[model samples]
Target: MEAYWRRTAMWYGGVGLLAARVVRNLALPPAYTRLVVREMELMGVRSLGVAMIAAVFTGMVFALQSAANMARFGAEAYVGPVTALAILRELGPVLTAILVGGKVASGITAELGSMKVTEQIDALRALGVNYVKRLIVPRLLAALLVFPLITALADLIGLLGGAAIMFFERRADPWTYWNVTTYWVLPRDFLMGIAKSVVFGVLVTLIGCYNGLETEGGTEGLGRATTATVVHVTMAVIVSDFFLTKLLLALFW
Candidate 1:
């Protein structure tokens, strides 16, 4: 128990320190523009297809299930609003974060772990270069900038998926479905969801980088750290979502 708590404390402390350094050194140089653009392509453009597919399926499922339940209660017409509310407020952000955590976070860990084990990171340090500024900053900034966009895209695609279900499955008019959905969903809800995505982006990148930096034991350790990065980021996003949701509700409601 003592060792467990000690390890946990060390992990958190390391992550906190990394976050502080990233924030302090956030000023971008002209040269870093290329790096940031590369990261944006890798993290944002590459992940779009998967995120969209997940959003569509999720919204379809939610609409189908909710429509059934609402029909039983003679409130089928309200299904559009309920589906939009749920997707925009919670599912879009959380699901997109989870997908990004699994894909991008794992890749970050693996790439960094490989570099660490190969002594490339130390080589940079030997050359008097700040690896954190050169490597971590670009990825972090990419995540921060791209995640909210992804979340918004997911929310929009998810709404379209729900609208499809309402029209085809529920036999509701397309215009009516969208009207109700837009009427019921407030701007604050959309903003709050985007806010959650931003926080999630920070968590995913930070956790991935920390695990990669701390990896040991050579090749075996690299694999372990990569796996651990995915697990830790997924858990962190989920746990944080609960608290963020409550806080947003208190602030907005």
Candidate 2:
């Protein structure tokens, strides 16, 4: 038990150091603008379709389930507000972050782990290049910029999906559903979700890069790092969500 706690503390400390380095590097004129742009394309633009699909389905399912229960009490009309609140305040950002973590973080770990095992990272250092700045900064910046955009998109699409269900399945009037949704969902709710998404984005990229940079044991280690990145990012997002939700409620509600 002592060893386990020690290792955990060390892991977090290392990640924190990496995060500090990333922040410092970000302030400098990017030495790898092209890489940052490419990463944004891969992590943001390429991932949008998948995030949208997941969000729409999540909203549809929430509406369907909530409507079924609310109808028992003839309160089906309230489903709009319930669904909207769930999507905007919780599901939109959390689900999008998890989805991106699986897709982007895993890929980052695998790519960087391979480079480490191949000693390409060492080669960059030997050439007097700051590998962290060239590699980690781009991914960090891309994730920071991309996740909020994706979360916003997911929030909008999720609401639309819920609204559609309210219209077609529940036979609620469109305007009434819209009004109820808007009435319950404040700008603060939207901002809170987006803020959580930004934190998640930074953590995901940092974890991935940390695992990748520390990879060992050649191909097998690369595989392990990739797997670890996915697991860690998912857990981090969920665990952080609880605290962030609590804080947001205290501050905004």
* Superposed Cα deviation of residue 33, candidate 1 (Å): 0.8
Error of 1 at 123 (Å): 0.8
lDDT of 2 by residue, 1-253 (tens): 9999998898899999999888787777646889889999999999999999999999999999999999999988789889988988899999999998789999998998999999999999999888889999999888889999999999999988988888888788998888877787788888889999999999899998999999999998888888888899999999999999999889877
Best by TM-score: 1
Looking at candidate 1, the ten consecutive residues that score lowest on lDDT are: 24-33
TM-score of each: 0.97, 0.96
Point out the worst 10-residue segment of candidate 2 by lDDT: 22-31
For candidate 1, write residues 193-232 as lDDT tens digits. 9999999999999999999888899999999999898889
Off by over 4 Å in 1: 28-31
Q: List the residue pairs that clash in candidate 2.
A: none
- Model 2 lDDT vs. the true structure? 0.90
Candidate 1 achieves a global lDDT of: 0.91
lDDT measured at residue 170 in model 2 versus the true structure, 0 to 100: 78
